[model samples]
Target chain A: MIYLELFLNFIYVGITSFGGGYAALPIIQHTVTKSNEWLTSTEFTDIVTISQMTPGPIGINAATFVGVKTAGVLGGICATLGFVFPACIIVTILAVIYAKYKKSDVMSGMLRGLRPASVGLITSAALSIITVAFFGQELLELTFASVDLIAIVIAVIAFILMKKVKFLSSPIAIIALSGVVGGAAYLIQGALV
Target chain B: MKEKRNYKILLPLFWETFKLSAFTIGGGYVIVPLMKKKFVEKLGWISEEEMLDFVSMAQSCPGAMAVNASLFVGYKMAGFIGQAVSLIATVLPCLILLTAISFVYVAFASNTVVKAVLTGMSAGVAAVMADVVIGMIGKFIKNKDVISVIIAAAAFVCVAIFKVNIIYILAVACILGFIINSRKKGAGK
Candidate 1:
């Protein structure tokens, strides 16, 4: 019964999700918290927070957590497999089709349209994260601070380093430096405020 | 010269993808350069332009960029067997890493250093994402196509402000693509 439910949930999330992992967030939130009642809204939020903090896609993380909470280790396996199953199958079919249709005009035209949409989605996500990291749940009007500004600056600098500096191309190093900057700002704010 | 052994071709592709899957932290744009490094510079599996094309295609698809990119790269490298190996390799690491991390998370759910690192890295992640967008924009602008820009703006408004469902956005894009292509073909005739 648990396996069946897991299978169903996996297929539901996998199939309905069409815009990538970030786009699946609302669906996972609604299903787990609102419909299934497996996780409270608070728990769902926490899972999202923690999942984002860790490395990997949020969909897989949520699936893994929900799977473990509902059942156990086997549940985890089922859920992970379910989450990845769609992409696996799609790629297999696409691999063969792609061979024959590699240079089709129709395919090229479709791709040209898809590019802008993809860029839009990616930009939206980036802007949202920037807002949240800087504003921290505050309203837009009341949120302008130095640390926030500094974080943005750090991001820009890191971008330049990545694009131009050539040697400081390590994402890990840039990430660590940004954290040090953020922590220092936090401490300074604590002392001043 | 290509090897004659049956498993020889598949093994290297699988191993390369497996390593990438295991190590690539903060998915998507973060992995782009790493991919460029491995696929273009190191392995010579595909050319740089082809790599960029694969990234563009992966983005338009309906899955994680890491997974989709891996699928294309793997297929381009070694065909069906390459795809299978890459999928397994890509997914296996995340599964194992998350499973192990899940246990530790239960205990150290609120570690300070961990939190700090995550908060900081997230900003960097945002930067990488912005870079990808800018890079794509540069590519699009070079084509000097008004249709692409208009569609891009429309999609941005739909997703970012209106928060319209992504499926609808994708569907509309697909329809628009078909319509525009067909009309152009008809006019040519």
Candidate 2:
């Protein structure tokens, strides 16, 4: 029954969480915490934090975290399977359709449209990430006081290196170096305090 | 036509996706640029333009961003099995890490050192994304289509300033492209 409920709830999340993982958090929170009571409000919030801490998509991370907590390892697999099922089916079908009709004028037009729109979408995402990183605030809520100069310096320097230096192109290198810098910042702050 | 399955290609695809799934932290948007680096830039499995097209299709659909992108990539490179392998590979890291953390979540969740590392990494993530935006927009600018440029600018404002739903903006932009391109008669992007 626990496995069934976990699969069903996450399947529901998969079917409806149309935009991306972040926008789906509230809906997931409602289903897991409010309706099933599988997790307390505090636990659900903690899962969100954990999602941030871990690698990969937040939606998959949350489903696995909840299912593993609720049932066990197999439960985690079940919940994850449920969550990814719809996307696989939907995207596969769409891909087939796209492949078939790709040469059509309408398809070509839509592709044209998507090009600029994706640029916009990615830009929006970039801005949001920049806001959270440099300012420690949401996109709409930035202020001069919330600014983190250390983070900004890291980002700018990384960007420059990524552009100029051949070896710095891989994101893994940048991410690892950023972590070390961040860890050092933490230690320095702790020592001063 | 059933695409012939090649274990040679399949193995590398699996390992690359698995490595990326494990290391790509931050969030959804970050993965695309990274994938561009891997698949388009390094592997030569896909072209630069083809990568963007797949990205648009992936982002347009509903699902985990990471999963959706992999689906397109797998489907292109290795067909249905590739899709399954990529999907499994993408989710495997999450399942493994989250389950492991579930046992000691209380400690893991409140660890300030982890927070600081992620904070610093977020800055790195931002720079990566900014580079992506600039790179993509640079390509768009090369086309020198005034209307397309306007569309890109307008879409940015709609999302960033007005806080509009991204789907709506995407819908309108797509339709505009359809109408305007078709009107030009024999024009194709």
Candidate 3:
């Protein structure tokens, strides 16, 4: 039941997810963290970090991780199957008849709305991750006193480095460096205090 | 393009997507270009124009774009067998690697140093996401339609402020998108 349940939930994720990449983040957060309580917010953020640093989409990473954690390797495969199942079926169907459906009004029309709407979805995800980066929580429960200034500083510097420095703009490189800098900074601060 | 049913193509398609999934770190946008290079330029399995079709089809369909793109390419090249092979190959890398990480993630996640690294990485994740948002917004503005703009703005408010579920937001956006854009289909010029 657990394997089936994980598979089905991820199938739901696969079906509902559109716009791709960061667009899927909010839905993943909703399914795994909020709706199922399968993962805490921190774990969700951790998965995002892992996905950023490694190859593959966060959906695959989430499904595999949660699957293994819950029920070993089989769970991982089951969840992954769920994650890719809907996409496989849908895209294959499109491939079969695509010569005819190419540029039809319905496809273009849906995309026009969906693409921009994805921007909004990614924006929401960005905000959520930003809040977690700064405050260690999902909700925007911010006060001056409660904020982690070091993390905020790291985020700003990371942003600036990305914008101003051409060599440092690679998202993978900067993210990896930020982890090093953040760890060292926190360690040094702990020593000082 | 001949529709192939040969079992031979199954291996090559699987290998190609396996390489793509193994190297691509940023998902849909990242894997897609490399896929173009490998499938279109190098192997010549699909044409330039056909690759563009695959791109749009992958992006527009529900689910992750990387999986969708690979599936489309696989199915187009061979048949249902190719599709199955490619799907397994594409997902295999992540499943193996991430599951390995998951085994050790609990231990690493509990450590102070690893916690610090993850925390720092989260900051970087946030920054990168913000940059992607800015870039997309600039592109969205140039070819902006009134309805698309309104939908984007409304979706942001609905999710970021009101905390509405994305399922609802996307549903409304799709229906709204279909209704508004469908009406403008006469010339599409």
Candidate 4:
């Protein structure tokens, strides 16, 4: 039953997740946290972090992670398969149809509509993650006093490194460096206490 | 003869996809330029125009853009079976790696240092997410598309503030887009 639920949930994600993997974050958050209560928001953010660190599309990594956490290996397989099932079928059909009508105005127009919307979804998703990463709560409840300065500083430094430093631009390097920084900070605090 | 030729290329196709999926660190977009080099320039399996078309189609379609692009290119080259091989090859590496990571992650979950590290990594993840948003908006600004900018802002509000379902937002945007585009066409005519 859990496997079945996971499959159904991811199938929905695969079908609706337009724009890209990042766009799927909101949908995943809706299903896993809001609807199913399978994971809390904090855990959901953790999965996003893991998905980025791992090699693959964020959507697939998330499906696998959530599936494994929910059920087991079988669940992971089912969820992964479910997530990509729609894409496989739909893209095959689209390939044929688009090939035939490569210059169709209707198709181009639809894409134009979709493009900005996808950006919007991605922006919202980014905001959601920022809220969780810094405030540890919903954005609406955010107050000046509730902000986690340590997280804010780490995020700013990571962004600067990725944007400015050529050698550390890769996401994996930034993540590893942040982990080291966090671990070192904790060790220092522990020593002092 | 064509059928036999496709069968011969299947293993190579799978291997190429597997290698690409395994090595690429970033998400779907990162693989595109590299895929072009291998599939178009080196392998000569697909033409440059065809590869660009595949990338665009992959972006427009659902699922991961990277997987979609691979499947589309495979289907173009060798048909259904080729699509299957490419899809499996593209996903298999990540599937295996994530499974392994999941097992180790459980064990590390309780470690204090690991927890602290994960906490710190979360911040980095946030910054990356912001960069993605900025990159998208920057693209719009460069294009100087006011409508797209408006739609992007509206969509942001709809989701972040109103908490509207994404499906509805997309639906509205599509309709609005179609209407505006058709009107522009009419004006041009």
Candidate 5:
């Protein structure tokens, strides 16, 4: 029954959640933690971390991991399916419809509204994660010394460079360079601490 | 003669687009590098310059980067039908993966080590997301569209300060976009 419930939970999340993995986080947290009682806050937090490391999106990973926990391999499969099936089904239909109406005014109007909303949603999700992960209680107590300030600064600089320079669309370069800088900073911080 | 010649050329492009879409792991900017390697380097379906242009268009357009990319690549390959084929090919993998995975999720999801790794990776996940947004902002600045900049700022405020539901923000942005674009079109006439 728990396993079945978990499957349904993932299906509910997958179908309703419109944006990407990050956007679905709060919803997942609410369902897994608040409503279902399937996972403790700590457990859910760990699930989120593990989901991030896996190959697929967080929502998919969460469903897989959580489903497996409750029922075994079958459960993992169910949850993952429940999560991704919704998006897949929806996107496929949308793709067909969008293709058919590629030139129509209604399509254009809806997209025009959708694009900015996506940007805003993406931005808000980023901010929420930043607030929780970096700027929240523990970091505040440390007075930002142990904070990943270098990462933040590097990110801002990268944004500026990308904005000002037309030649920097190879985001791979920026991600790699930032990773190196961030990794080095963490090592230095660890040694100092 | 033209029909036979076009089919000869178009069929392979459909297969190629399918393969590209199948293996792309993460959505949005995560697949940018992979697409560059495949489309720009391996297949020579498009140039690096063209890929960058596609990225810009994909970002600005409404919908997933993956879908937008398919449209661009498919259109470039064989016009309209290519777009349909690519979109299907790109989307099919997710459907298959989801269908297969749904049956097995409940079992493997409960382990201790798995939980720990997932927790550790959350920080990394956040880092990656931050990286993408920052990179986009840098690119966006070049466009110098005051309206876009303002929209971004207002969106940040609406989300961060007001803590409004995302759907509401999306609705407002859509309405605003329609009005603004319509006004611009009217003025052009």
Candidate 6:
């Protein structure tokens, strides 16, 4: 039943996830965390981080992780397949249609509309991620006191490293560096306490 | 002759897609240049213009860009079977690698250090996500398109503040775009 649920859930993600993988984040968050209650927001954020560090598309990686966590190997396979299925079908149909009507006004118009909307989706995704990363569990309470100063600092440092250093610009490098910094900071704090 | 040619091209097509999927990171846009080099410069399967078209289509469509591009290009070159090969090749490497990582991940799921690292990496992921938003919005602004800017802002508010479903937002935008674009076309004529 969980496997069926995972497949059905990701099928929606696959079809509606316009604008690429990042835009899919909000949809995934909404479906997995809010609707189904399969994962908490914090767990979802961890999956996003892990997905970024891994190869392949972030959306697919996330589907795999969530599937496995929710059910088992079968869930992983089902979710991954569900996530890709709609895109495969739609893109194939689009390719065939586009080949026939290469210069249709409807096509251009749809792209024009979709382009900005995708940007909006991505921006919303960024805001949601920032809120979770900076505020953590306090997101629900909406209090200034809940802000994690250390996490904010790590985020700032990571941003600077990504911008200033060429080698550390890739997401994998940034995540790795941040993990080390976070681990060290936590250890130091633990010792002090 | 066509059947023979398609059979000959399928293995190389699969290999090329596999290589691209294996080596590229960052997902969406990172694969573009590499695909351009391989498809256009190396293999001569498609022209630069066609490649650009594929990239845009890949971006605008659902799923991963790498997979979409590979599938589209494959279909263009060798039809349905080609699309299947490219799609499978594009996903195979990541599927295998991630499946392996999943096992290790579960074993170490309880490690405090691992937990701390994941927590820390979330912040970094947020920063990277921010960059993506900025980079995308910056492009539209640079072009000085007032309508696009407005649409993007409205879309942001609709989702972030109002919690409107994305499907509705897209539907509305598409209608608006269709009306505006068709009018512009008529006016131009």
Q: What is the C-alpha interface RMSD of model 1?
A: 3.4
For candidate 2, what is the TM-score?
0.95
lDDT of 5 by residue, B82-147 (tens): 665666665454444543443543444554444333333233334545655654555567867667
Q: Score the docking of each candidate (DockQ).
A: 0.42, 0.74, 0.42, 0.40, 0.19, 0.38
TM-score of chain A of each: 0.76, 0.94, 0.62, 0.59, 0.66, 0.59
In order, candidate lDDTs are 0.68, 0.83, 0.75, 0.78, 0.57, 0.76
* Residue lDDT tens for model 4, B41-74: 5688887546655765676678898899899977
Ten residues in sequence with the least summed lDDT for candidate 3 chain B: B25-34
TM-score of chain B of each: 0.73, 0.90, 0.57, 0.57, 0.54, 0.57
Backbone clashes in model 3, listed as residue pairs: none
Question: Tens-digit lDDT track for model 1 on B113-171?
Answer: 56655566566656666665676667678978778777778887887788887667766
How does residue A76 of candidate 6 score in lDDT? 84
Best by DockQ: 2
lDDT by residue (tens digit), candidate 1, A45-111: 7777667666556677778777776777677778767876776677667666765685787766666
Residues A1-193, candidate 3: write the lDDT tens digits.
Answer: 8899999998998887776667778888898888888888998888887776567877888888888877889999998899888888788778877755657777656655666676675566677778877887766566655688888999899999987997776666667788899989888887799
Per-residue alpha-carbon lDDT of model 3 for B69-108, expressed as tens digits?
A: 7888887777778788888888999999998888677665
Q: Give the alpha carbon lDDT tens digit for every residue of A1-193 in model 6.
A: 8888999899999888876687899999999999999889988887786676555788888888888778877888889889988889988987888666756899777667767776776677667667777887423356776686777899888888877998876655676677788878866776787
Q: Rank the candidates by TM-score, best first.
A: 2, 1, 3, 4, 6, 5
The residue pairs found clashing in candidate 2 are: none
- Give one digit per residue, the lDDT tens place, for model 6 in B113-183: 76667667667766676765676677788989888889989988997778776667877877887888999
Q: What lDDT, from 0 to 1, does candidate 6 have?
A: 0.76
lDDT of 2 by residue, B88-187 (tens): 8899888989999999999887788877787888888888888888888887788787776788889889988997888888789889989888888855
**Model 1 chain B worst lDDT window (10 residues):** B21-30
Backbone clashes for every candidate come to: 0, 0, 0, 0, 40, 0
Best by TM-score: 2
Number of the predicted model whose lDDT against the real structure is largest: 2
Clashing pairs in 1: none
